[model samples]
Target chain A: MFTLLLVLLFIPFIGAFVTAPLQQRKADVAAVIMAGAVMLAAISAIIWAGGGRFDYSLAGLPWLTVPFPLFGIQVDPLSSLMLLAITVVGFLIVLYSAGYMSELNKEHPTQAEKDRYYFFTLLFVGAMTGLVLSRNFFQIFLFWELTTLCSWGLISHKRSSVAVQAGFKAMVITAGAGLFFIAALLIMYVKTGSFEFSALGQLPPTLRLTAVIFLLIGAWGKSAQLPFSSWLPTAMEAPTPASAYLHAAAMVKAGVYLTARTIISSQAVPAQAGYLMGGLAVATMFFGLILYFFQDDLKRLLAFSTIAHLGYMFLGMSLGVAGSRLALQGGLLHLINHAFTKTLLFLAVGAISCATGTRSIKALSGLGRKMPVTAAAFIIGALSISGVPPFNIFWSKFFIIAGAIQLNSAWGWTVGLLAIVESLAGFAWFLAVVHRVFFGPASPAAAAAADPPPVMLIPLLVLMVLSLLSPVFGLAIITRIMGG
Target chain B: MYLLNCLWLAFAILLAGSVLCLVSKRHKVNGPLAMISMAAAGLLAVFVAVQVWLNGPVTAGIDSLSIAGFPAVPVFTVDRLSALFLGLIGILSMASVLYTQGYLPHYKSEDPRRYYPPFLLFVLCMMAVVTVADLFYFLFFWEFMTLTSYFLVVYQRDNKKNLEAGFLYFFMTHVTSAGLILVTILFSGWTGSLSFTAIPEIYRQRPPPTRPC
Candidate 1:
């Protein structure tokens, strides 16, 4: 069973390898197989790990030192949840890509870029799995760099000058972060004489602090926190599936995961660091939300929204309370909700992009009459991200605010109130975009557009349903994983 | 001991295959074959990594070879942490290889098959950095990984944008590596041992010997 978890981690790579030789027609089939395998693996891991914290260890072989100082793998509740999230969301994104990529391919009949696009898509899933499942810093860094590389490839898949430029920018920013990550790992190894995370926690306070700060820097860069966040909005040049996978489900969330892990494993930082983290989170949330309101590009609006939500998670971490726990839970839960909701929105955008060849909100109107399913999915996603009642995001945002109020600090209250206002403002902006695009008079594009293929619509519909029902299941999962 | 040699052999084979493709002008099937070999080697390395992860640390060496009388015995050790990293390298490299299959075709018209094979070798270098127990070997693999990746980043060498991206990547990576090397040397200088196992006691016994800052 442990081997199965390991296999699940590697299966996407295997699937990716198999897809390399496949023809254009077979690429989608290959993608489905890989995605299905990931979903199955995730389900098995959840069952095997038994919904609570459990650790599985593999024996050392004779070739390597039996107690190899640097080698380890463990699956606890947190990682298990992450694994499931990556796989489930990854599967849907892959499904959505089949239609989206096929449509893009048709638009460029003279160009033969379909095979390369699908291949990178499959590989991205595999790289993400590696990232979430690995147990030590070294492995994490390796997988982290892999994601940067894969992202660059996917972002540049369009072969356009703009796409290439955007891909290059993303690579530099992320790889810059990757350097800090390697430095942190080496420093930790030197200080503690061990690279395993389990061992690092046992190190002296000073050493632990060193490791934590370095790791936090790395995480902040990857998660797109404040000063390092500019690359995320620019990353919108890629196809929608790439955007969905990179922004909502996998890449950006890695930062939150790192911070959560560091906080859990290490002792608290000094009050200064806490305040610094908190201040940045607050600023990022407000700045990102404000910027989101100014975007005419539908996907860019969502990109800014992602940055803002990431800010909320960071703010929750800085608060440090029983409130922090609830806040973290809210933050993490919102991650799951955002994954579904944002992916749905991106898919809808992709469908519209396909029909009209534009993502400009100003140019799109009355699409609801033509692509009603997509329009409806977009509405649900918009509502969910905006924290409207009964949606999963609402519950998460509610807990975040509740956690803030519990802190009883004036700053906490202020940030919490501002967060709510910013969230509502962001929501209104999204609603305006949806109404302007889907509900008003038909634009030239909407008048001629038809529904996207079933391959795409079905996935969007499933995500919509998941968004609707997530609060019920999300609460249960959080309870089980957090030992509540 | 023999198992350790086999691991190195696998990596060496991958390295050789990469070089073979780079030197060959024909460019047919070399890229895919290089990827396959690297993938297989990565899988095998994963098995080794899992073992170390479960048990603790495993060390193996063959003494027959002599490198300037320092004993040319290439040693491989997988500690609990290194095993995790090894597994990650395998998984990541495997995926990259798969993507390269599709990604390479985009460059096939331009005869850029040389890039894929070298990229696989670069993966091996990264794996080596995580698993090599000796400081010298670790540094060797670290530099190799950086250089190889630098080349891969410049796959679009004719394009100024790609060249600039590659330059930035190289600059950032080397700077980080310098910091890492300083840390590694500091610990080794203080402890007088390059082995990972020997450094913990040194750090434990000597408090504030050198401030980390």
Candidate 2:
């Protein structure tokens, strides 16, 4: 087990170093090796499972024990499932990048330029994986920070002054919010003495409240919820590939992951925290809806939508605290489901932009004929985000609502009503956009547009299939766990 | 355990394939080679996931791989939930890798060579993140994941905006790290142990300290 951990944990770092000096041609070799290693490690871990959940930690690494005993590998039902999302969805993005990124780099980069891209991209993937698998807050924090850095890098990849500013804003807000997380952890340490998640319950009520608030603030910044949401839309300055992989799928999810992880690690978190979370989620959703409908840029529109969906996940989490386990389950399922949906949408945009060299919604029209697959994928993605049934997002949203109602608190139901209203509004907006982008006569951009390459199309098809099938799979896992 | 070994063997095959792809990336055949290996790995992943789902959780430890020659008991298990995840991962990976085959050819203006390596590793890191149970290894993978993706983001680095975003992202990530570190310190106190297994037991035994909100 320890051997597997080491291989899985360190391959990317090795790949990064090896690929650093290599030119674009050679770096491809290193990337394949590293990815293969990670895939193998993931499969090996799955194979070790033989069909159930397990938790084991490889401990005793000296450097791993910093101020605390932090180095250890642990995986259970949740993390492993998350692994599926991370690796699988992540792979598709990488694959997409091969086509998408290379196409964008019309100027043949120097060997060093190519090397740097591979290095940081590999590191980002590794960091996100590590963050999810983390067993304790100390380790989680480490991975969490890495993800933030990766987000900044990915966001600013285009290095447009606008992109740089957005990335900077994102970093400042999230990192600043991170101060609260630091403060929370410090309080936890002061009250307790260890870095294990189990001791979270020991903090005095005041301290616990303080920590919870701090943690939420930190998560809000990272996840782009509420007041911090402005950066997410602006981050659309990044390439669509980066937006899909980093913002919509992985990095932003770090905050969601943190929120969920906190609830799991700490027992008996005060209900007030849950209520506060509920309030913020609701506000974020409303904020997202307001922003989502007004976007002229396709990616920015999707970005707002992502912020809204994130709000949904947070809501489910908050409800889990004050209301129902179903809420938590729904929230997590939504998180996973959103990964597929959001990535597809972003990729679809990439295809359209690739075809027409434009990202404006107003500029794109009647693309359905030329880029049928991408248009169809975009429609599905929109519907899923809007909560259409048979699609995965519908079910998760349903569960979140059900969970909220189950709380039986008037406040809970009120929140549920607001969410429903927002969801409905968002749904209508997506439908409208779909009609505008895919149904109308071809705009000038669409006239020249063509379907994306098979590489991009295939991933879209797969995502569509998964989006359709996810509810069944997600529900099965949930029922199994809830049943036992 | 035999199944587990099979899983590892399959992964090793994948690794070999990656090496091959790396060596041959300059050649036209690298695409097919990548697909074949990724497919094989994906199939194995599905196989493992299916077996685990049907059989229940698989838990074991190989202390022989311990660090510092002072064996720290390490366990990694995959249960129904994990298996479910593995299956999803396998399906997605296969689909995406196949997609890459067609996608890479569009880069008539630029070389697609550098994109593949980080792309693959990024996927791999995400997979590792979810399956591992240890806090330390998890963090290691997580950080690596970030670093790799960061590069992907900045692939168009000359644009300048990407650079600014990189800095902000770095700052945010550090703050989160700081917060997380503090939280971990608190948790370690209750159990006096770092193993994740120590957590629930503590939660079960001790109620959270009450505080007036």
Candidate 3:
């Protein structure tokens, strides 16, 4: 089982380096194969981990001054669930990327940069895997930086001036704020002499508050909350698959993972910290929703929606931190749910752009007539991401708001009402995007467009199915994480 | 003994390269000379740092370096924290020195001597700031680092914006250095010593701050 965990963690990294020098077509094949292997490995590791927590240290250097687990793997239900999202969704995206990054596609067609694309994409898979499995702050921080670097590489894949600037902006804001995480880690290490997550609970009250605040700041920057969120929209300049995988699915989730992990592992997190997190999260949520009305570019719209969805997760986690276990479960569940849903939306948009060579909402119309499969995929994804019922995100968002209402406090009720309003607003807006872009008379571009090749459509179909079934699976996993 | 030798070798190489660049007649060789010297020195510094990381703190310095009636202090020390900074400085120096090769060509009209010497000195000052064990000497090297970096920032003296940016950087950093120096002075006064090792004991004795939450 441990070997399976190791395989799940390292195979993508090894594949990433190996694929870097290969020819474009071969690299694409190798990437899909590698992602498939990782998916299988993740399933096995999850089954082995079950609902129980386990930690394994690769090296036993007892003499080392830095205490706690070193080069260690921690397996539990939360990590296992994240593993499923990253590897399974990652594999699908890689499959889609293989078909999308080719001469056959219409929008920005080029097979020339496939190697670089796959390299960073695979590296992100490995980094996200490592990040979720890390047992301690030290290890998580290392993988966190690796995820940032991989996203920077992918975001700037085209090397256009805008892409490069977006990449640097993302790097500077995230990594610079990450310095606070390091400061928190150092404070904890100085006090407890261990980097393990458990050490955070043992800190004296003042130090714990200071460290938690610092850690949350770092998470905010990574997750692109208020004052740090400008980078995410600009990041859409990346290749669509990279945009889907890195921006929409994996890397942004790492921030909420940190917050959720903190809330789960420690009971001593200050109420002030929880309130602070909830307040800002709600603020970022509305911020994202407000920006949505101004975007004509479909990908940028999805990007802002991602920002809002991330806020929901942060809000959920903050509720949990404020003493609502159900909210914590919801937050963690949202991590999985939103990953699948948003990735689907991003990829479906990518397919639209591929077929029509345009992503403008105004420019694209009546796509349903010409690309029915893609239109259906987009509608399903938009609904799910908007937290519509019976879909994946609805379940998580319901739990989060339910938990908020369960708190029975003014803060809880206010945040809950805000979340509900945001969801309604989001659904209405996305419904508009869908109706305008997919319904009515076919525009010239939509008349010419058709469903993408099977390579691309399969992933969308698979994700669409998952988006529908995710609630059941998400509940089971979240229940296990909560020891139910 | 081996760690000490590595440290000395690294410093000696950097110092020799700085001097060589200062006196070099040909501008073309200066870039390569600085690059090779910085690379070799960085590698050695990192090698010593690795040993320090694996084997705990290593003090590689003169045990006694009294000036007149001044209290004797160890010159250099490599602990886990210092070693980490040393490794970062090593990596950054290697990168910036290598970058100088391409960057220098753009500055072909300017005297190359002005650029390479200050750059090497900047790296050397940074290394010294991390390695010096005495708080007083750390401050000394810290100030030197700022000066050399300012010189590098304004290397193209003809650009007014560059000069203004350099001055802004120098002013802001020196103010920071003043705050650091004030804290260092307070610590030295309390501990009755200038060694970094002594300040920790004083810190441990102080009462913890009040909890905000």
Candidate 4:
């Protein structure tokens, strides 16, 4: 079973390598193959992690062994679930990109950069797979950095000066965090005589505290907590697929995963760490939601909302193990839900941008009449992200708020209240965006624009349906994985 | 023994390739050549790293290979952590290099060879810094990595913002390196050895000093 998990991680990388030499004309074919590989990998990972019987292994070469201890990879319950989330969402986004990018390519004929886009997209999926399945911190960090590099490429894909600047900012901020991460690992090695995560997990109290704090800094940067939150909004300069990838599915989730891993592994770390995490999470949530109210760009508003939602995940994970167990499960489940819902919204936005040639909220109006299907998908996604009932995000946010209230601490109560306030603020903002863009008098562009091609619209519909169905599957996974 | 040879070979190839690309007249081939050499080196490093990751840290030394009183230091130690970083470097460099194949055309009019190869070399140097176990080797690679990347960042010297970003990045990374090196030196002095493997046991037996440094 663990071996199946390991294989799942490498499948995308293999797919990427196989498709790399394919000509630019073969971009769609390559993308489909890559997406299919990811989907199969996701299915296998879910089944294996769901307690199904499966096992396989490739033996290490005997001659290369230097009599040193080697750490083999494992796919336990946690990794299997994460891999499943990454692949399912990643595959859908790739499918969505096929139609969305082609439309953009046609509109800007000189911008026929299909090869570069597909290559990096495949690379990103593969790297993300490696990140989730690796049992060792080293492997995780390797994949983590790969995701960073891949993201920089994606963010700068538009090649505009603004996009380039945003990419550079992201690189520096994340790379700076990477340095702190390296320092933490080095210190852990210096103290424990090993870099293996299992070894570090057994460390004494003081060492554990230091490692945990170091890990938190890395998470904070990657996840866009507090001071690091600015870059995520800037990342909206990327294409909608890239934005969805970074915000909902892969990159930001790395931070949540790191925090969860550290807290779970270091069981004896002081309660102070939890308190600190909770405080930061609460602060970031309110700050993000407050900022979201001021944004006029549709994507930027979503980006800020992403920050607020990330805060909920962080806060949930910080309330100690008992509190965090449910919180972390909720957080992870939210990540999966966000991937579908956000991608749906972004695809719809991309379609809207194509037809209207504008992203400004004020300039666009009454798109529902022209692009009815897209408008409906966008509404579904918007409602789900706002935590409306029966949607997957609502369930996860509910669990997080309930977890906070159960903590019975002043900070927890404050966080719970803030969660409600932030949700209301988010809902209000969404209503404003949707109402202004979809219901009011038709703008000049809306009157002339037609629906996007079915290639694009179908993916949006699939995602909308998935978003609606995700809650039931998510609840079952959470209960099984977390024993909630 | 083979690990030391492999480390030296990889470093020599990287140094030669970077220098060639920096000085070469034919700019068109420079990026590809540098990428190939790096890919070779990175692949070897990954092989060594995976071994370390799966088994344990591999340690080796070519003692007294240098004439100076200082011992001929170990050049490479593939511990589990280093292996992880090595894999990251391999994967990232591979993608960055491939992307550069398409991206360099945008900069071809401005000496593509000089712009791209140095960056690849810089990435290689960063990978080396993460894997080297000895303090001297670590610092050497660390400084080299910073210098190469600094040049790459400022490759667009005509742009004032580019130069400013480069300088800022240089200053920040140097400051970080200073802090890291200071800690390394303190650890070395405390343990009376530069080998990272020795420090953990030493620190375990003797609690760290009043202040970490």
What's the lDDT of the predicted structure labeled candidate 4?
0.70
TM-score of chain B of 4: 0.82
lDDT of each residue in A181-237, candidate 1, tens digit only: 777777766665555666557666776566666777788788888788988898888
Tens-place lDDT digits, model 3, residues A1-484: 7787888889999999989998778998999999999999888888777778888888645665666547889889878788888899999999999889988678888899788888899999999999999988888999999999998999899899999999999999999889999999999888988888888999989999999999998998999998789989999989998999875558888888888788777666899898998999999999999999999999999999989989999998889878877677778888888888888999999999999999999998877768878987997898688665447786587668766876778998789878877876787688668767876568888888989999999999899999978766666777777777
> Candidate 3 — what's its lDDT?
0.83
lDDT (Cα, tens digit) per residue for candidate 2, span A1-484: 6577567767767876887788755666666567667767876775575335554555645643334456577765566556666766766765665556554432222233556666777787788778767777777888888878877887777677987898898788888888888888788777786567776787888878888888889899999987888788878776677788775557788898888778876765789998888898999899889987678888888888888889999999998888577678889889889988888888888888878888888887777767768986897798678765447786688667756765667987688768777876786677667656775467887797788677567778888888877765555545443433
Looking at model 3, residue A234 earns an lDDT score of 91
The TM-score obtained by model 1 is: 0.66
Worst 10 residues of 4 chain A by lDDT: A63-72
- Fraction of the native A-B contacts that model 4 recovers: 0.00
Off by over 4 Å in 2: A25-33, A50-68, A104-112, A479-483, B1-213
Scored against the true structure, residue A251 in model 3 reaches a CA lDDT of: 80
- Candidate 1 residue runs with Cα over 4 Å from true position: A58-69, A103-111, A203-207, A267-271, A321-323, B1-213
**Candidate 2 C-alpha error for residue A201, in Å:** 0.6
Q: Which model scores highest in TM-score?
A: 3
Model 4 residue B8 CA deviation in Å: 75
Please report how far candidate 4 places residue B68 from its true position, in Å.
69
Query: Which 10 successive residues of model 1 chain A have the least lDDT summed?
Result: A103-112
**Candidate 2: tens digits of C-alpha lDDT, residues B83-183:** 78877877898898888788767755323434555555565556555565554344445655654565465444333475456545533553354343333
RMSD, one per candidate, in order: 26.5, 17.9, 28.5, 28.4
Greater DockQ among 2 and 3 belongs to: 2
- List TM-score (chain A only) for every prediction: 0.93, 0.93, 0.98, 0.92
- Residue pairs in steric clash, candidate 4? A1-A54, A68-B55, A68-B56, A69-B55, A69-B56, A70-B54, A70-B55, A70-B56, A71-B54
The CAPRI classification for model 3 reads as: incorrect
